[model samples]
Structure formats: structure tokens, C-alpha cells
Target chain A: MKAIHHIEKQTGKAFKLKKGAFLTVIDPMGQQVSDMVLFNSHDVNEKLSSGKSLDFEESILLTKGHFLWSNRSNKMVKIIEDTNGRNDFLLAPCSKETFEIMYNYKGYHPSCLENLYTNLKPFGLSMDDIPTAFNIFMNVQFDQKGKLSVLPPTSKGGDYIKFEAQMDLLVALTACSAEDSNGGRFKPIHYIIEE
Target chain B: MKAIHHIEKQTGKAFKLKKGAFLTVIDPMGQQVSDMVLFNSHDVNEKLSSGKSLDFEESILLTKGHFLWSNRSNKMVKIIEDTNGRNDFLLAPCSKETFEIMYNYKGYHPSCLENLYTNLKPFGLSMDDIPTAFNIFMNVQFDQKGKLSVLPPTSKGGDYIKFEAQMDLLVALTACSAEDSNGGRFKPIHYIIEE
Candidate 1:
């Protein structure tokens, strides 16, 4: 497939993808996390639900051959390829308060919530439309005691995950702005949608 | 105010609530849990987010004077009156797999997922639209060690929680089908919407 559209998503930027298309998200700088939220193109109410996806897959890890299920819809997108095999499914998208509560960052910092609202506004969506996202390329592990922590991505430059849109989709992706657990800066993400 | 509509929701039934409306969900038989999901009337992409509500209120319990925030939207519904004062905000609505994995329930048992889908279809919504819900009247508590358990509701017959819509909204509610933590049977719920 050839690229029909390319988006160089900087930290906290967002973009959309259409249906019957393939989107490959690239970690150009490597070890950086990306947050993504998906919704039906025609109906904003029909958005991806990580809880339902986890329940449907019966696993905490989303990998190749797994489908991302929207809360009401049976399938929205499918993971066709995974380079890192370490994407996170457990963490909700980082919000402004997440920075404050989790990292003790004060004042306005970059957040997936703000990025999504800013990007979605052209399509008539706002903060109310932001949903929990699939944190692509994020490494999160839980200990036996159930304590969880985010880790730096294991991906190298040019590493990517490809998703096949099961329906016409409107996806919002954010090159996360939070420091990784290892205190490394978040890097840029690149994506292309091809027919 | 008089009820514009009233529904006698048997176990596993779902219904919708419109905007600018007051919805009173009653634990008619007492100790029964109700699972509720809300969406923006014009856009399914925006659904209620318990995480956002918890963060907005800085509390885990949904009580009178608290506003339920959608993940992106600031507030979607307000708890105008809560008689039981014990509404849960932590548990996702129970699904078939939850029953199977958690309780060893076998075969076609009812589920909040199915109920929400069945009820939402009339509004042109399907499974993808079912976001995580506000599990009203469900008694869930976390122990000091952070172990969570669902306890039987403290509500008696006629106990209810009332909510006022903050936007034009569509709500799907189910009289939950899972057995309570105490192994009690799930009971019916009733609700009325007043303009």
C-alpha cells in the first residue's frame, strides 16, 4: 500500500484516519509512547473501549491478531503488525491532572486530553469526546502484587505497529508528552494511512 | 415534577434517558445494582468516563452535589439527590466473561453488555457504543490492602439516586444480572424521567 496521507505528529498532536485504510504509527525517535483514541467516523458515540477490548480478548496485552473492540461495537480495528510487542493496554490516557498527581508536575502541561480536543474540534468534537485511549508503544508492567508502572518503550527508530481499520475510523493520536518511567523525554510519532 | 416516562426495568433490561431530564433509578426490590452508560445525544463518541468523574470530584463515591464528567467533556450529569449515599463509581458494568471468570457462570446468562446493546439499538447504537458505566447502587469497596470486593447494596425498596442531565444526553441503564458479592439474586429496577 502506498501512503495517501502522512502525519508527523509531534508531542501532544492529534490526527484522524479513515476506514478501509492501514495506519502505521512510527516511533521515529524510539522509546517514546504514543496515545491513541478511535471512534466511528459517522457516530462519535461509538468509540473504542479498552475495558471491553480486554474483556473480549481475555488478555491484558493487545498484540497481532487481536481486535480492538469498541464498547458497543464488536470490532473497530485490528492489530495487523506489532514490532515491539510491548504496547500498553492498562493505562488511561494521561490527562493534565495525571501529570500533577502522578509526576507532581505543576501548571499546564501537555496532555492527551487537550491534544484530542484541539484536534477533534475541526470535526466538531470537544473535550467531552475524549475517551480512554490505546497507549501505543507504551511499556507497562504489573508486579505480582498488582502494582503497575510505565516503562520506557523498547522500540528502536523506525519501529511501528500497523492497524487495519475495520470500519471508517476517526483516530486521534498523541505523541505523549510525559516523561517515561526512566525519565526520558517523549519523542515524535509518524503515521501514514494507505488504501 | 411528574414523570414524563417510567420504566419497570426487569433484570437485564436497558433504557435511554434524554437531555434536560431528571432520571430517578430506583432499587425497587432493594439491594439490586443498576448499570448506566451515558452518551451525547448528537455524538456517540462522547460517553461518560468514571475516571474523569472521579478526578473531577476527587472522590470515588458518586453522591449528591457531585458532577459526573465525561472523559473529554467537563460534566455530563449531576447527582441531584442520592438517598442511599452509597453509589459505586469503580466497577465497570459486568459482562458475560466477567460472570464466567469471576463466578463460573456457564451458558447464556444475562449481562449488562447485552442489555445495553439491546436497549440502545432503537437509538441506532450497538455494542461499540457501550462505554464503561456508572454502576449505581452497587456496593463495591476496597480493603486497606487495595483488594476490591462487591458487596450487596445497602439500599431498601424505593431507594433511588436522581441525576440531572448537563447536556442533551442518551443514557442506557440495566438492572444488573450478576450475582451480588454476597451471592444474592439480582433484582429489578424502576426509573422515571421527568422534564
Candidate 2:
């Protein structure tokens, strides 16, 4: 329920966007993301809430990008941009395979995503059916042929898109696998979610 | 080797720093971080590969101001500004106390630091000695009496205090726990690790 203004310091101009407007993501980098996925819930069905642990059925239902939910408000939060790549963050899913690949698998933290699953599985969630999601910052671009591949990000400080969430949604995001050397060293990204 | 220049885009100025700099961060805003915690890793002695997991030591070390660390190249990375009021970060460690205070124990994430310790105990780590970290970007400040308290950040994009990592240290960082309500949520941030 607060208002955020997008100001470009270079020109000292600001864009006063509509509060609770739809989400709009813009990819300025001009590239494609590999295996980038989008998932939505059916707001009309109203299958999710803060207390409800997400399930395979609910996750699968979200495949069409239409199993809509709401935030605290009835307004919408847009998936404005996939600035960098289009991959669904490469379901690497933090496995021992990942540990072995990254750190010789000799000594893993034992608490990667796989460990998360082993712990959370008791609550009725399944990673197998984890809905593919749009990688927010990673970029995946398309060629003229629409061939999917990873690309660099077109987003910067002043560059941003807008969107509206039709309903209150519980969003799950995996920052990214700490594999590649992009994203300028996993520095913090400040997200300005507004009303 | 690559050099990361913290560029102040508006003024066209840059702080050209080498890779692996010793960065001392401060949280101006001592706000209750609902999401992630930030910190200033004054010095992490464990060895680190280019991309690897940081072994957070059990004891918390408060990196004093003006402390210095040298890299493999023997380059100096000084703590130019070890302590500032939370320019744009919160200074809080991740713990059950932090969670209880911030979220009011309303909800519990199984993976919280408290839980992280339970799982890590088997690995010879305990909750008392898990990790001590500063909440970067959330804002914390020092009063005239030198009292540490949380505040809002005063940092703009590209306005970073640079330090050369005295050595290749495994650093694990995530975006702050703030939203677009403030100046966050748009672009997470661009922290380049120039090697």
C-alpha cells in the first residue's frame, strides 16, 4: 500500500507507476534464456494460502500460469522482466551430483535443495512436480529461429518493468545455483515490491 | 586479473578495486529483517576456491575498523569505512532470536539458522558456533555513544565502499530483506567481484 517511483538519475526523470498495477518485466539485454518456465495459479479456484504447504497437484495446476493466488491485497504483482537468461534456473536442484561437480562431492554441506526435500517431503510436497518457474535475473534469449539459449541480462539499476498480481500468491524463488560466475558475484539484489 | 570499478553513474566516478577485497559493511537501518540477514565479514580465514561454499566459523568475529587483509598478490584491501550507519542495509545475524523478534514467532522456516545448526551439528557444528554475519543493505548505524542499532540504507546503486579481498575467501551473500517500499526491489544490486 505504498507508492514507489522509478527515477532515472541520469536524466532526473521519474515514472510514477500505478499502485497495485500488473507486473511488467522488460529484458533490455536482448537475449534468450534457456528452459525458462512460467507458472500461474487459478485465482478462481483459490487453492493456496499462507498456512497451506504447496503440493504437487497445486504446483501442476499452476503450469498454465493461471492457478492464481493473491498477496495480502487483491491487486496483482507482475512478472515484469527476465532481464538476464530465460532458463528456469536449471533445475540443478542442489543435488549431491551438484556437490560432487562443484566441490568434488567429497564434503558437501548436506543441506542443499536435496536435503530440503528430504526434510520437507514429510509435509506432502514433491520436487518432481515442482513447477518450472521463470528465472528472474538470469537471462535466456532466442535467436531469429527462436532457438533457446542462455544470454546476458539487459537489466540495470534504472531499468525495470511493471506487473500486477491478480491475487495473493506464495512465491518460491531459488536465488540461483552458485555455479557460474555471472551476476557480479551473487551480490544482493534489492526488489522493490510495491502496492 | 579483473578490476571492479564501483561506478557512481551519476557523477561518472569509479572506485577501481581488485578482486577479493576485504569489504567492511555497516547496516544503517536497524529494522527488523523479515527475510535475510546482512553482515561485514571483516576476515574469514578459511581457504576458498574461486566458486565454493564458505565455511562459516562457529565464533562470531567483529571486524574492527581499519583492519587490513592482503590477497595472494599481496595487494592491500583496507577497511576504508568499516562502520557507517546503515547506508542501505540491516545489521542482524540470522538466529532464532532474530526470527522471533522480527517475525514474532508467527511462522517458522525449517531451514532457519536454528534449524541449520541442528542439521549441521552432525557435521561437527553447533548452534552456538554457527556463523556471525552483518546484514548488508538493510541499514544499521552507530550512535554518538557507539551503540549499534538498525536503520535504513543511504546507499544508491554503484555507491559501494571497495576493498580488495586479502585472499580468496568463500563469501555467501543474498539480497536484503527489504522490498520496493523503500528503494529496493527494483534491481537487486550489482556487486562485481573483479579478479
Candidate 3:
């Protein structure tokens, strides 16, 4: 087991996960959300695909035993364990525009998209390269009419989900910046990569 | 009215539309789908955004009177008329991987992603630049549990959706190739850009 890494509120981290290694994302403060994106370290173009994962999984509620698939139709990671099962793949990462348009705030705001691109820039990723993220611990519900609503996470402190990487992967993770996503208060998120 | 431009079955086209021009996407034959992507002509970085459109519109089913929004929180186009009210923005443009993974086909296959990148190349758009398209006449249904299913388009011949460009735009259109999306057959799509 490796030491836990902490991602401060409204911030992000980018790292590489070896094939077969376990990566566990922990909502240490509960009610907070984390956004995570993955790419094949070997070929960045073969990145995580929300549409493919949702299509192949056959359910929007992806949990334990379901695989996260890539744009190239390859499995990237498998969820081995889930303490809090609700996550969202339906929405893109929040950005500055999200706050202005949705929240009606006009000033500088930290956003998951900004956090992600800033941290991933070292890996040669750009704003346009970011995709719809796999939002861990974020609860998004949809009605029969397909209207979506973001709700506070149902996780308690120390809740986590564990995944086993299927290939060498570049992963970006963020402590979500949207107030609506984190019950109106941002909190730090923690992760551990087990060798 | 300008002459109708035909996009061959399982193929695509790309062009530019001046601001205030009307672009009507027509399902010339029944039960076909067209995937459309829009980019700001002056700044490709500010392109159509599915999440922002869904968030701002507050509905997954966008029709007449709903505006397609950009990543930068600007309205890119306004849907002024819709004869076939159903459309989908929840899914990405189908790619070769879609056939291999979902349909279990091995050989080469036509795909919206390929058509988009091919036609959009002259506009300086690459494969990675393609975003989740606004799927005209594509009927995608979701269950109460959030599971999604692609159903046959409900459009009849001559059904069309008209959009007034809110900005000078670079547009890509694809006559979709996925069998499930078009109810087991492919058909050409038609468009007219009127000043």
C-alpha cells in the first residue's frame, strides 16, 4: 500500500497508474465530489469514452464489476469495490462558463475543467482534449423525461471506490469546484495507488 | 431558399454559415439520422457544448425555441422550427469502435466520427476536435433507471429542423452509419443554408 495523496479543495492532480495496480478514490470529508479522467499513457488519443462506457455497461449507474471503457473500445479500468455507488457520467466538468451561465456568478471561479487542464498540461493535455469526466461520488439523477439534476453526494467520510487499471494510464482527478456538486462547500479528496 | 445539399448515405459534409443564416437539416428519407457539430468560425475553440446546452436549456429534449450553446456560454444557434421534435445530444458520434464493440463487427465500417473528421479536415479540424454532436432525428430513449437505448428515428420524409446561426459558424454534418440509429438502414440527409 502506498501513502495516500491529497487533493486540496478546488484543485487537481495528474499521475500515472501502472497496469493491474489498484487506485482508490476517497471522499474523505463526505458530501464532496471528485472528477476523474483517464487516457492511455501509450496513446493519448485512445482516451476514456463516456458514451462507450454507458453504451457497453447498459446502465448509467456504473458501479462495482463494471468496466470503464476507452474511445478505442478497450477496457481501461474495472471497478473492484464501491462503498458509495452513485457517480455521474452524464455531465461535463464544470467550467468558468458553468458558473456564469448556471450559477449566475461573474467573477473568477475555480472549476473542475480548469483544475483538470492545469494539472494535465504537464502531460501535454489541453482544454480541448478534456472529455466528459467520470464524476466520482457526484449524484446526478434523471427523470423519465431525461431531464437531469445534480444532487449532493450520498457518501460519508472515508467512503471510497476502488478500481484496477487494465493498462498503463494517465489519470487526472479533481476536488470538484462547483458549489452545487459538493453540497455548497468544497472539500479535499484523497486517493491511494496500491502497488 | 438555397439549393438543398445532399449528404450521401453513411457520409458527411462540412461548410460555413454566416451569422443570421438559416440552416435547415432535413431527413429527406424517413428513419434516418444526421449528426451535426458546430464551431465558431472565428474561434474554433469556442464550439458547441452538450453539457452547457443541456444545462442552460434545462431539458434533454431540445426542440424549437431551444438554443444550442457553446462552451464559452454563448448561444451558437437557435432552433426556430422543428418538424421532427425528437433529437439526441446524449451520445457521441458513432465511431469504428462502436461497430466493433456494440455490434460485434470486425471489418471496416463507416462511422459518423470518421465522416466528421474527413470532411472537417479542410477546416483544420482533427479527429480529436470532434465533440458530441446534436443528433437530428435520432430517437434515444432512457428508462427511469437511466439506462439508454437507441431507437429508430421517428421522422418521416421531408421532416426538418431549422436553426438560425447566432454566430458565424463552421459546421459538419454526417448521415449516420449506425444501423441501430437509423432502424437497420442508411439514408441520405439533406441541408439548406439560406441567407
Candidate 4:
């Protein structure tokens, strides 16, 4: 695997990947989360749909061998490898409001929503350019009664997940800014794209 | 209120409004759901955030006297009048996958996600344009244990909800296409923009 890009903590970045390329995200600090969004390279209209992907995989939790499906198009990417299986698809990306409402903290806190909009602007995209994301390494769990909670990631440092692009894709990722429910600090993540 | 535009049943439409204009959705045939999304008129990037709105209103159910807040810009719209108080902000707009997965029916299905995208295209907006919607007139209840279930709308025929725009807004609405969980039929909704 060749390292193509390195995303800093509490920031976002975007890249284009050709079909068959492998994209990997590494949690360098163990407990951080990566909020990832995918778009069709040829047509920005289609995007990775967590709802569709979950339905396609017929599972509540994403795992190796499951396909990530776009809302308009079918399969867009496939998860072929995973070192930490604690990713979450149920939660929306964190925003300024999330910080203000959930934690009572205020004043320009780092947010995945802002990071995504800022990073995707070079591609001429805005906040209205993507759907909800796949929050990799963020541990969120729901009980049988439907109550949900976010938990500290169970991944260790150096853990990662790899996906194979099934089509030309534009990917955006945010090293999440919010502290874990357990008050774990956010950290940087590294990425690799293999030809 | 003078009618400016009328939306047919199971279809979607978009309109632009200056601050203070009132938008009303009428359940003409009753027991139908209208999935609605709102965006900033000057910048499509900012959108109505159900989470933010819920937090601002400090309630789970949207009713008369509540404000609909935007994710970035804060308050966007206000529910000034509501003939039927039953509404939802927790559930996402239904999609083809929702029907296929929940109903075991596999075929083209009318979805709020597709309808919203199709109607907003003329405005150069797409699926990424908005967040989860305000499901007007859709009755969703949660038990003490947090289990949720969709119920037939409590709205009667000709009942409606009216909102006063707090900002210049771009609004998209879909007369929901999925059957009410209780096997209630979907019906058309009439919309009026009062100057």
C-alpha cells in the first residue's frame, strides 16, 4: 500500500480514486473517529447512501465484504479489509449545533460538517454536496429497545480499514473534532491509496 | 391565504420565499404525510437542521409556536399555525431501500429522497442539499423504553400546518409516497404561499 495523502486532526480533505483503487484510513491515535463521505466522480449528484448501503448489506453494522451503495447508483465501494470493526453508520456528521446542543460548548468548535464543506469547495462543492456519512472508528451502539449512545472507539493505534473503489469516486474525510463520550481526545488519521 | 402553488399527491415541488412569507401544507384527504426540507435562498449551502430545530424548540414534536432552526445560521422558520399537531423530526426521508427492506417489496417505489432531489434539480440542488426532513403530519411515537413505531397520521381531512419564514428560504416538499404503517393510503397535499 502506498501512502497518498495524510489528513490532519479536526480537518477534512478530498481526493479522486479510479475504479479498483484501494483507499485506506488509519487511526494513528487509537480512539479518534473519521467521518467519511463519497460522491460519484463523473456526476456529483449521486452520493454514498448509508441507508442504502445498510440495506444492501442487510446488516446493522458494516463489516468486511459489505458493499457501500449510492442512493442513485447501486454499489460504489466495497469494504475488503477492516482492523477495527467499530464504525458507525447511524449518526449524522457532527456540526456546530451538535456541540452547542449536546455539550453546551460554543464558539467555532471543529465540526465535520464545516470541514467537509471547506474541503470540498476546491471541487466546487458545498455543504449541500453530500449525504450523511460513514463515521469510521466511532463506536455507536443501539440496544434492543432502540436507545442509542456513542461509546469510545475500541480501536488501538495503527488500526485501519481499507476499501476498494468499484467505480470512479470522489471521497471526503474528516478526522472528527468532537471528543468521544468517554472524553477521549480526537487525533489525526493517515490515508493510503494503492493502485 | 391566496394559493400560489399546489402540489399533487405523491409528488414534490420547490419554491423560493422571502422572509415573513407563510407556507402552508394541507392534508386535503387526511392521514397523509408531507416530508419537507428548507434551505437558505441566497445560499443553498445552509439548510434546515431537524436536530438544531429540535434543540431550539426543546421538544421532540413540532407544533404551533415552535421555530425551525438551520444548522449553520440558527433559526430559519417558525410554526405559526398548526391544525394538526402531529409531526416528526426523528425519522429520515424514506427511500427505495426503505420500502424494499421494511416491506419486502422490490421495485420502483416513490421515495421522499428521490422526489426531493428531482424537484430541487431545477434549482441546481441535489441529494446533498438538505438534511433529514420535518415529516409533517406523520405520527411517530416512542415508548418509555425508546422503541419507535410509525402510526397513521392524526390529521383529519383539510387539516394543515403553516410556517412563517424567518429568513429568505428555498423550500422543497414531498407528499410522502410510502403507505402509512397502518395500511392507510397516501393522498395529495395542497400548498399555499401567502404574501
Candidate 5:
């Protein structure tokens, strides 16, 4: 199958998917991470909720057969297939604040939050509107004490996860920019949307 | 010292604290939970960020001497004391969807999200502005596989946690409406703000 679209390393893309369509996010290069956020096309106020999904799914690691629920209790998408099973919903997408505070960087940096808002701006979503994202191919672990740590993804080249839209949706996806998230190397992300 | 105020069962309150003021949240009844959210008084855009605080503090279990950071990478408050040490920042405040989807309750229900937004409206905040809250005395445990569970709070009656505001702040506190979070019972939350 041919990929209809691809996001370059450290960048993002935004688009709309009709109800019943399928979206496949591909890690074209090994260990790259993609951050994805979804909003109901008919009502932007009803967006993806990490809390709801976690509560309903009863698991922190989401994968094939799990449904991503919205803040309004609606199912936005259902994972139909997942070759790379580890995804993170606990952390918000990396931002400029992430670099400044965590990485100790002093200057402007490309971040998932910036990429998401910029790409979604044409769809009228602002910076504050961004929610905790479904981080694909991202590895996050927690200790018994509930302390979280970001680790390099385990996905290999050509690995992908596919989701079937449960409703008409506006989607934003990022080729994550955080060095820690991508195992210290940048790589492109590929995706295909099919009816 | 007397409690400045109290939040009734399943209710919420909003207040402001000057910089350097200490705010204490008390679990007057053991096993009850309170959710807290903070905003910068001078700039609402710079509000509490779980990711930042978790990153800077290097722990998910925030306790005494830890500082809560904002989205702007500025300190908002420092945990001065913690008698009930387990606080949760991983979950968003329980909302109407939480009831409908998780509990399978069909009718209208009280929720932390509604209480927070209603109480905070006077301060120019809306439902969308609410972020993931800091759940005081909420016992959330995760396993080695990352599966999370909400357990009854380990706090005893009269246990309290105190924070010193690093900057002037607008705060919203809730006597959490979620049944599981509070061990299947509703109870009040007490708080005091001191110079």
C-alpha cells in the first residue's frame, strides 16, 4: 500500500477524516515518535480525553482493539491494527517549556506542541486547545512509586498502527521533536488515510 | 490556626492567594480526595503544568519541598508540608463523561470538571481552560506493566498538605465527585490560607 502523506522529521500535519475511514501512522525510520490529537469534526468541543480513554480502557498501554474515547464519552477512533504496541498517553506533547525546563535548553526549540498548534491553526485550533496526545511509538515507563520516565521507542522501520475513525474527525500528528523521545536522532513519519 | 474555608461534599471553591501565602488542604475525613488546579493571577495563560512540574521535580509523587511549575516554566507553588503524601497529577478531573462511560450512570451527575468550571467562571475561566488536576490524597498506583488502579486514599482524618505560593495564584479546589477516587463515599475538604 502506498502512503498518501508523510511528515518530515521534527514537523507535523493536520487533516480531516470521514467517519469509517482508516488512518495508518508509520514509523518510516526506527524509533521515531509521533504525537496525535483528535477533535470531533462536528463539534470541536468534544475532543480526545486521555483520562476517559485510560479510565474506560483500564490500561495505560493502548494498542490494537482498544477504542480512544472522547471527553464527551463518544468513541472517536478504534485501533484496528498496531504493529508497534507501545504508546503513551500520560505525558502531554513536548513543548518549548519541556526543552527549557527539562532539557535545560536556553533558546527557541522545535517542539511537538508548536508543531501541533501550527499545523492545526488552519483548522482554528489554538495553542491552549491542544490536549494530551496519543504518543505513537513513544516508550514511557513508571516505577512502583508512580515515577515516570521517557525511554526510546521500540518500533522498527516500517512499523505502523492503524485506527478506524468512529466519527468525522480533525486530526493533528507530529513527528516528535524531543531528543529524548526519538532516541536522540530525528526521523520522518509516514501515514496513509483510506476510505 | 482556623481553616479559612471549607468545601462541602461534592462541591468546589475558587480563591486567590498572594505570593508567599501558604495554602493548606485538609482531608477532614479519611479516604476522601480533593482535586486542585492553579492559574497565574497576572496571566491566566500561564497555568499549572503537570508535565513541567513532574519533569522539574523528578517525581510523580509530589510532596514536601517540591515545587509545582507552570506552563511558562515558572514556579507557581512549593509544597511546604504534606501529611498525606500521595497526590495524583496523571488524571484529568472527573467529568460528566467519566460517569456516563465508566460508571454507566445515565442521568446527570455531579463532577469535578463541572464544579471546577462553575466555581472558576467568576475568575474568567471556562470548561476548556481546565487542565489535568493535582489530586490531593488520591491513591493511584501503577504496576510494573503500567496498568493503573485507583485505591482508597491512605490519609487519615485531619491529614493536610500545605503549599506556599511562589506567585500570586487563582486556585480551584474540589471535594472530588468520583466515587472510586474517594473510596465510594462523598466527604468535605477543608483548607486554610495563611500569610
Candidate 6:
């Protein structure tokens, strides 16, 4: 294989992205993903139900290149690989206090933010620079009573998410450090950010 | 204030735990937790660097919680809870890939086999019945190495961690989220986890 270092300039030695792009969703390699839910952080207003024609917004939100987990299994998973364009992304870690309010507060952990900072140093990112994102596989939804209900994630093991970029963007990812009891399971979600 | 419905147990609030007496670290209200390590799971050979300090193991892991975002910010952040114990606890989350490699790709996510699993679900322990842990916010000197290194974390954006149990625990904390940023800048260094 010919090794190509860095693309100093925009060289047209590549492929073109169509107006519409495609993505693939699957479970992480060697994981048994269970119940989980994922929503687009950029656009919470968009809706896309399974077994239906996904809209443009759904396409972006459910696009591959992102992943989710739940119940030690990944029911709905996606991993996006945007060749046409780029996608903006963010990475957020989980913690405890939210645990008690969310559940019986069974599982407890150290600061995931602390982990993100330590690992990001290898890549050169920082806490302040990190953007906000949805808690993948975390099934949180609003009800008719305007109450937020918790749903098990829709992702299963080995599930992945893929999508084409709508535009040029920066994506950040981390192998979350949530406790195993809640079922995020500390399983490393497969993350591949490629051109 | 209106009184909420309270149920009186005929047995006088008797509870049953695996152990007659359960031990864990604690952090009370308005307390300043200090330097300590949190593992993703219970530690077997975890050695301390000082006098015989009392320690406890979390019955489960920690995925998400509420915690103040400042070590010295003096600002009380919510959701400042994770894990059952305060210090000397692990069981934080890692990436899905890290999950596979660390465990030789044998177990699944949030499976509690890998650290990732424990991070997602703490007490529901699975796979190995307990996963290895990432020492978050703790200074350790491995037996093989004489130098002590800080075990940071991965998290950001008003992130907080807390722990809740029949009992409470105190723990020192630090916000980690810069992989390769300047001295953990994406998020500045703040030691929260206070009361």
C-alpha cells in the first residue's frame, strides 16, 4: 500500500460526495449490545422511526460514525464515514450524581471528564474545547405530560453507525468510562473518523 | 412544606446486604474530597502509598453522576455523585475498542467483563462478574515503576460524578478531558467532588 502522509493542500486525487450519502450501523466487535436509544444532538427536533423512509435530518442524526450502548447489548448502533463531506462531532463523559436521579444510583464511577482530559492529551484536545453531545444508547424522552422518561438504549453488541458528512466538521470520540451496571458497560464503542 | 407520603416498615426499616457490614468511602455534604483513585471495578491487590488508610469498594461501577466542576472553584455543582465509595474506587468507562483489546476481544460491552462494561453498569456486574478499573484521579506508583503517575479521566461540559449508597463516601477529584491539549485545556483543571 502506498503510504500517503498528510494532505497539505486540497488535492483532487479522491472521490466525490453525492448530495445524499450512505452509512452503516452495526454492533461493536465482540459486544452484546442490548437496549439503547440515540438522538441527534445538533437537531433534537428531527424524528426518524425505524422501518420507515428516513428523512434528511434522520439521515444525519442516525448516520453511521456514531455509536450507542445499553443493557450490555447494542440494539441500535451506527458508525458514520463521511466521504462526501465532513460532520461535526463532540465527546461527553458520564458521571454519578446523575446516576441517583436517573436510577437507584446503583453504579458509581470516578470522573470520566478526568479520563477524557488524560487521553485527549495524546490527541491534543482539551476539556474547554470539547463540545456537547447526546448520551448515546441512553433512552431519555419527553412524554405527553412533558415529563422525561428513561428508556433503555436501543443498541446491541457489535452494532455500528455510519453516515456521509453533510459538511466539513471535527469529530471527537472517547471510550466512555461509565460503570458497567447501568449497561454502558464501559465497552469501547468502535469509532473510525476517516476521509 | 407539604409532607410527602412516608411508608413505615413493620420491621422497622430493616435492610439486607450481601455482607453483614458493608464498607465504602464517603463524602458528606460540604466536604472537600481529596486526592484518591477510583477503579472501574473492585481492586484485589490495590496498595496505598501512605499509612493504613481505611478504604471501601463500591458494590457497583459508576457511569454518570452529579459533581461540582471545580476542585477549588468553590462552586457547588450538581450531579456530584458516582460509585458507592469516595476514594480507592475504580470501575470507570473506557472505549469499546479498549474493551476488546484489554480483554483480548473475548467479552461484550457493558458486559462488566471489560472496564467499559463496568462503566456502563456498576453493580449489575457481568462477564468477569467484575471488570478491571481505570484509576481515575489517583496517584499511583506501580510495582514495576518507581515513578508515580496521575490517573486522569475523560469527560467534559458541566460533567459531574457522584455516588450514593445506604452509606456515603468521600473522594478527591480532578476534571480530565484534554487528550492532547495544552495542560488539559479543552477543560481546565478543577478538583471538585465537594459537598
Top candidate when judged by lDDT against the true structure: 3
Q: Could you arrange the candidates by TM-score from highest to lowest?
A: 3, 5, 4, 1, 6, 2
Against the native complex, each candidate's DockQ, computed on alpha carbons, is 0.13, 0.01, 0.52, 0.14, 0.51, 0.02
> Residue by residue across A22-103, what tens digits does model 2's lDDT show?
4433333222111111122332122212101111111211122322222111223334443332222212233444445445
For each candidate, C-alpha RMSD in Å?
Answer: 7.0, 22.2, 1.8, 4.9, 1.9, 21.3
Pick the DockQ winner. 3
- What's the candidate order when arranged by decreasing DockQ? 3, 5, 4, 1, 6, 2
Error of 4 at A48 (Å): 3.0
Residue B135 displacement (Å), model 3:
1.1
Taking the tens digit of each residue's C-alpha lDDT, what string does model 1 give over A1-195? Answer: 565333343345445566767888888877877888888888877787765675556466787888898756358899999998778655567678777755688898877677777888887887766667788887766543333566688888888899999988888888777675323775677887786
Q: Is candidate 2 or candidate 3 better by lDDT?
A: 3
Candidate 6 Cα misplacement greater than 4 A, ranges = A1-26, A29-92, A96-112, A122-124, A166-170, A180-184, B1-195
Error of 5 at B45 (Å): 3.5
Model 3 ranges with Cα > 4 A deviation: none
Between the candidate structures 2 and 5, which one is better when assessed by TM-score? 5
List of clashing residue pairs for candidate 3: none
Query: Using alpha carbons, what is the TM-score of model 4?
Result: 0.73
For residues B21-78, write the lDDT of model 2, one tens digit per residue: 5443222222222222111233322211100111111011212232221111122333
Estimate, for each residue in B62-175, the C-alpha lDDT of model 5 and write its tens digit. 898899888666899999899988988877789988888778899889999999999999989888778778889988887776677999999999999999999999999999
The DockQ assigned to candidate 1 is 0.13
Output the lDDT of residue B134, model 2: 32
Can you tell me which runs of candidate 1 are displaced by over 4 Å?
A1-18, A181-183, B1-130, B134-175, B178-195
Model 4 chain A: which ten-residue window has the lowest total lDDT? A51-60
lDDT of each: 0.72, 0.30, 0.91, 0.78, 0.88, 0.27
Instruction: Pick the winner on lDDT between candidates 3 and 4.
Output: 3
